[model samples]
Target chain A: MSIEVENIHKQFGSFTALNDVTLSIPSGELVALLGPSGSGKTTLLRIIAGLERADSGRILFNGEDTTEHHVRERKVGFVFQHYALFKHMTVFDNVAFGLNVRPRGTRPSKSEINAKVMDLLRLVQLEGLAQRYPAQLSGGQRQRIALARALAVEPQVLLLDEPFGALDAQVRAELRRWLRKLHDEIHVTSVFVTHDQEEALEVADRIVVMNKGRIEQAGTPDLVYDHPANPFVLNFLGNVNLFHGRLNQPGADQHGADENAVSYVRSHDIEIERSPQDSTALKAEIRHIQKLGPSVRVTLAIDATGEFIEAELTRDVFKNLGLQQSEQVYVRPRQVRVFVEDYQI
Target chain B: MSAPTTTYAAKANDNHRITEPALVRWGLTVVALVFLAMFLVLPLAAVFSQAFEKGLDVYLTALKEPDTLSSIKLTLITAAVAVPLNLVFGVMAAWAIAKFTFPGKNLLITLIDLPFSVSPVISGLIFVLLFGRQGWLGPWLDAHDTKIVFAVPGIILATIFVTFPFIARELIPLMEAQGRDEEEAALVLGASGLQTFFRVTLPNIKWGIIYGVILCNARAMGEFGAVSVVSGHIRGSTNTVPLHVEILYNEYNYTAAFAVASLLAFLALITLVVKTVAEWKVRQQLGR
Candidate 1:
């Protein structure tokens, strides 16, 4: 199933949750609505699921309008951030809830329902916990069971709102990979909302970056990360050292930035070396050096400007430099991207 | 004195006591226990002791009186009518307050708690002033040959007003803490509003519902001030249990009055037991 949202606008009192947002997800693609908190990613997902109503917009499932539809009629499986599993129901019963609530004529027989629930439980790898209540299970197990319950009705679209947000770091990482494999096998039109950029990049096939209730950029992970549309997208994706001075300065590489625009250079794009007698690289003194496992991050202050910028180098290369704190060195950017407009970090 | 003070400090250090000294602690404990005995336990024991003061036979005869039996029946009827109605209203109001946002929500909650802050006699009078013979709607009711004030309907109305807040008060905090996530999940899973309430929401708050009902029922049966005003003390007709107790005590029928009062006390004891069980059930569910 394909999901389409057109001209959606939602307001909470004076605050705008989504501002004329439009998005279209093709069938069988795992897309992520990625943004920081209050960026309207969750609001868009809820509107798509019919859990929330847009002020004026149309939601279409496979090109059929479903804007007026109730959440139950939308046939979109939604998983909540907190894994809102029914606390009083057993895992099997929770998974079987949708089927059990169906009208008698359309409802499956008891045996068929039982089999289907058990099969879904197995798919989530929680078949052994069929009889256990939700509180008895670990956080990861509870979330998997939540997903299985959502899948029991065979929804046309799967929507998850920070499905692993409540889990610890290790469990979150494990589930991120597991969800990617699960999506491949199931191939539902899945759209998951997440603020964790790494999770979105690693798990989603396409990423929609939203900021301040608007879609800033949407594309495959590599495209958005490498060729961001604006400064917000660039800064949001990863660490970047921003420069406000005019371009063509000493040791500054302007790949796309014009002379007057602000420059943004990735931390790893910086090169540090001892100044040769003839070198024209920007003169700087290393202020601080942090040795991460694979790379060393050195904070350098430019002599001409007294501004601090970070440079990253692999451990082997950094070791060859024999750098010490407060040692004088020259720095140069290898690649720089600049946007014309100003945006606060 | 210095030696004793040193010993007290040593004991405080031994226990890592952050509270007051042993003298103050023991004094406060003794005071509270004595207060409980004076106010709660003694009065409760007096009700039973006075009832049986004459003899077991006299006590039995007093309860077996026609007026006493009728009052008991009337109290039961009032509770039966008032509690279920409040339960429905309480659940609906709590659902609206806890789950959704709208205008005047805080006002509605304040109005729901109006009975608790207002005097019970005034609560009864408000209904009377609207339904009494000379009240706002009194002439209209009189024209239709209907009676409300100082009647069974008025008694039931008064009881309902005082006890309605109990269930809603118990449920709002519970539902607010529980959040609407589970209910929203149920709706997304294809369950209808009614189905979600029954299957997911009701089961989760079943113990809370029971706890509120027990408290409400106890209040409904034992209400004195509100029912006293609305009930015209028409013995064997409109007299509820508390009204009958007042009538007996006023007429110097001390034995009968305490006998009837003992019955209400017994109901209260039973309510306490049931309430404790419900609270335990809530704890167990939450512990899960």
Candidate 2:
């Protein structure tokens, strides 16, 4: 199903959780709502699922207005962050719940319900544990069961709120790969909320970065990572070294040469050398050096501004240049994205 | 002087041992056993011993009396009516209080627990004031020719009033702890509101409901102070088992009185057993 959320707003007492947010999701695409805590990503997902009512908004599912639909009528599958499985139900029964609870006229036969539940359990790779209760399963297994149960309804859209948020780091990685594979097989329109940027980038076809109840950027993972729309997206996606200074060169774009312009360069973007041959090269002193696998992380303290920046170099390059701690060096930016300081808020 | 200091140090080391002395442990155990015997064991023994004092046949005969039989029937009927009514109220109240947030929620909870703090006799008296001839709503009730103040209905009302909080008190904490996530999941999965309640909410809280119902049933059957005030001691009609026991005791028929009291005690024992089982089931369901 294609979902279009138009100007959604939500508030809890004095705090505004979501503010005039709009997003459109195409059919059979997996999108990730990526943000830090209290960023309103989960709130937006819940609004789409009809679990929460937006103070003012219109939600259209495949050209049908679903804002007035009850949660039962929405036909949206929602998986909670905590794997909210029924504690008293067996895995099979939990997966069969939607089929069994269908209104009598449209309800499936008993044999069909059994076969469908078994198929779902197998799809989640939990067919052998159908008799086990949720409490008996590991956190990862319970999460898959929650997914299978959500899928049993044959929903138009699937929504998950931090689907792997509660698992350990190792399990989280495995589940991300597994979820991507599962999405490929089902090809359902799916949205999942996540705080882990790596998980979002690895699993989702598209990422919507949010902060402070607003969408900072939305694009393919590569687009959002390489071309962040603002400072928040830049800082949130990956590690960066920020240089706060005035633009010295003239005839730049009108918006690019402000006195408070901040230049952001990824760690790998800074070129380091022993001699200052280029006019753009800034003098710096090497503060620290650490061997990180095949790369050497060099922390440089620029002499002109007394500001610190990091450069990641291959070990072979470091050895060829004979670099060492407390050594003097010249640093030049290979690439940088500059933004005004006023863009923070 | 050095020898004396060394010996004194050894004695101090003995006193500073981590575990308590064996004699103190034994002494504490003996004291706890004595306390238990005095408070629990003695009273239970007294009840059973005094109950069979005359003879088995005579004790059985007392229970077989028409008035005694009628009192037992009255108690059963009261519990049958009161327990189910309160069970329904308990489920509804717990659902409303735990699953949703609304204005005046705390006030509603406090009102539900009002009977716990009020005296049982006062509970009966409140009902009496509402239904009695000289009290509020009395003239209308009189004109309608409904006899509630000194009848079976009055007894049932008093019993219900006193036991109203038992099931709800057991349920509120349990339901609140279980939370609303499962119900929401069910609803999102295309289950109707009623279906979600039955399939998700009710199953999760089944043990709590059973635990509450047993306690409610016990209180409904054994209530004395409230029932006595409202019953007016109508022989074979309004007197419950507890009231009948009081009547027999007041008349100096100690054996018969104790015999009737034993039945109430037996009912209490059954309730205790069921409560233990229910608690165990709840623990199992919670995966504790």
Candidate 3:
């Protein structure tokens, strides 16, 4: 079901954890709460899961008020960073625990519970390890078992708190893809918390970038990547060479798309050459050169303004141009996106 | 063929070989072993020798007497009642101390360990002042026709008070070491607090609780001074094994007294075994 979080506020004594944070996820949508640590992403997730109550907020589940509901009554499943499986129980028992703890008057038959646990085990690809304890499972296997356990109750919403944060890089990547596939098959409305930008970019259908207890940007992957709402969103999302220069004109040549007139160019949009071509071109001194696989990242500083910029080129281009450190070079912007500058988004 | 080279290689191997520590450690270890044998082993040897020197038939006959049988039965029954009750209380108290930061928490912890610091004789006196025939609650209880002192209830109360902190103290460090992540995770998984306690919290603290209960039971079965003061030491009625041993000694029944004392000591030895096994099991589970 669709979930709506309206103007949520939370404070731990004097520390304001989340400040009037608000967002909505449609039914069957997979949203990622993307932010660095202490940015209120996990706090927001816990609020939605009903693990923590907000100082002021209204949460609606399919237009019904669920703010006062306890976590058990919320029908929301949660998977934690450490997996939180019962160490004394076997993998089978761990997965069956949620179903076994069903509310009064709704207890399932033993056979029904067994069948559901088996189905979940197979879904998580841990069918062969049903009798093994949580202590006997690897990090990735334990997390999968945790996921299976969370899904056992057939919850309406699933919340994952950095589910892959504890795994090694390779395992994190593998589980990230597996989670996306699982979400696609199940089509349950889900929200996952993560501080890793690559994970948020690759796994989620929509990304909500948070900073300092506020939403900096929220959109589809392409929308955020191609059109970040502000400097924080852009710098947090990916590598970008930022230029701070005033726009001289609004002509097509200057590539200023907005009237207010300052522009930011992507590192990939800056072209470096041996010869100057137009009035837009400026001479810069090469400060540093780094070879990255087939490309070379050349850091350049403009001579006139002493402003720094970075440009990426093919290794072949670097060889052809014969650029050296401290050598004079010509640089021009191939494309620029201009936006209205504001302190808040 | 290469005699000189082979000699050099042998010398190199000798230089690289690890040398064990010298004889000083071995001499100290032998001294320590002799000291342990003299101080710890000789007394136990004397107890066994004195108990059994009269032969099997005499020992069995002494053990089969109604007084001795009742004492053994009483100790077992009291421990059975006290251990499980302490186990439950211990876990709840440990959870409170380890997980929550509340007012009076430190005071509560200190109160829990009060029995350990106070003399068992003093402990019994405090209870006597509160529950004795002429004490504060004594008249009220007598008016209601209730009994607390000089009975089975008195023995149980004395045993419970003395052994109260054993299990909780053992579990506090363990629960603290595991931290709060798993419990919080269970809370988030739609498990109510009770369900979370049973499924998540209980399993982690199970070994520590077992170890603590074994120690408490061993101590409860052998407790003398407190139960003596509270129960008035009525023969075959309020006499636990330790109290029974004291009575036999007073009556010039030295052989039977040592025999019964040795039996209680055997139970204590078994408790040690159980505690060791519990620790090993905990380590095995942690290894996983």
Candidate 4:
């Protein structure tokens, strides 16, 4: 099943949580609503799940309006950030809750529920912990159990609000990978809300970046990252060096590529050398050097503008150059992207 | 050098400890114990001691009196009617207050504690003004041939008025701390609204509800000021145990009055035990 949200607007008192937001998801695709706190990603996800009502808009499930439907009538699965597992219930019963709460005509038999719940437990690799209550499990274990519970009902759509937001760093990374693999295996239409950009880039098939209750951009991960439509998306995606320099060279305005006054450049796109023969090259001084595992980052300040920028170099290249702090260097922009003043969302 | 350093460390450790001096600790303990003995233990012991003053046979006869037995029944009935009604109203009010936002929310919360701020006598008098024979509703009730004042209904209403805030006050903070995340999760999982409440919300706050009910029921059975104003001191029908005790004492029936007073004290003791157990259960649930 596919899901569509159109012109959704939600407000809490005078605060606008979502503003004229619209998006559509194809069947079996994993989409992410990515933004900072108070950016309304979670509110938009809740509206799609029918847990929250929109101020004015419609939600469609395969082209049929479900705006006025009750949450229980939506047939959607929702997972919370804090893992709202039933503390009074054992893990086995928590997973079986959806099946047990079904109406009499469609309810499964007792043995069938047991088998299905056990199967879900095994799927989450928590079959051994089935008899344990939620309080007895670790945070990672509880979240995994919550996911298994959300999946038990065979929902047509799945919504997760920061599913890994509460886990520690190590467990969060592990669960992120596990969730991606699980989605590939199940392939149900899914939308997850997260503020972690790396998670959106790594796990989601499509990323919708939001800012101040507005959709900044929505596209494939690389499309939104490499070809961000506006400055907000570019700055929010990752580390980048921004500049506004004049370039009167031949194709500065002709070719679509190098329309120099390169508005922004990624850190890796900034190239540094000991010396350059070209007059157009910018002169800079190295301020600091940080050696990461396989790459070294050189922080430099432009001698002319006093502006700072970062250039990432391979370990092999850095060793060959023998660069040091306080050293004079020439820098060049290897790749450039422009964010126009008249940009539209 | 090492010896001097060790001695200095020991002196610093003594200063670091937060323990009070022996003299101060003992003084505070003695003061508290003296006050408890003077104000609490002695009065409770006197109730039992005076009941047995006329010998075991006389105590037994006082308890067996039909007036005393009927008063006990009336007290139990008042609590039986009042406690459950307040329990339902308290849970609904707490749920609405803690989980939803609407106009006059702060006003509603302050009003829930209205009975607590108002004197029990005034609470009883308010009902009397509404339903008594010479009051506003008196003429309408007389035409309908219905009697509310000086009746069991009036007694129950007064008891309920004084105890209504107990459960709601207890549950509000607890339900607030445990946000509505679980309820929303249940709803998205296809559980109906009623199912979500019974399965999720009620189970989460069950211990709090029990603790509140114990306190409310204890107060309902022991209420004197409110029930006295409305009950009119009828012999059998409207005389609760507290009112009966007062009447017997006024008539110089000391032995019978003390006998019933001891029973009320026993009820208080049982209430403390159950309240503590329920509180401990709540602590354990939260600790998890």
DockQ of every model listed? Answer: 0.75, 0.64, 0.47, 0.74
Listed in order, each prediction's TM-score against the native is 0.94, 0.90, 0.84, 0.92
Write down the DockQ of candidate 2. 0.64
lDDT of each: 0.91, 0.90, 0.86, 0.90
Sort order, TM-score high to low: 1, 4, 2, 3
Report backbone clashes per prediction.
0, 0, 0, 0
Q: What share of the true interface contacts does candidate 1 keep?
A: 0.86
TM-score of predicted chain A against the true chain A, for each candidate: 0.94, 0.93, 0.90, 0.92
- In model 1, residue pairs whose N, Cα or C atoms come closer than 3 Å (at least 3 residues apart or on different chains), thus clashing, are none
DockQ of 1: 0.75
Which is superior by TM-score, 2 or 3? 2
Cα RMSD of all models vs. native, in order, equals 4.2, 5.7, 5.1, 3.7
Q: List the residue pairs that clash in candidate 4.
A: none
Name the better of 1 and 2 by TM-score: 1
Better of 1 and 4 by lDDT: 1
DockQ, candidate 3, comes to: 0.47
List runs of model 1 lying over 4 Å from the truth.
Answer: A246-260, A276-280, A291-294, B1-20, B284-288
True-vs-predicted CA distance for residue A77, candidate 1, Å: 0.6
Deviation of model 4 at B280, angstroms: 1.5
Residue-level lDDT tens digits of model 2 in B137-163: 889989999989999999998888898
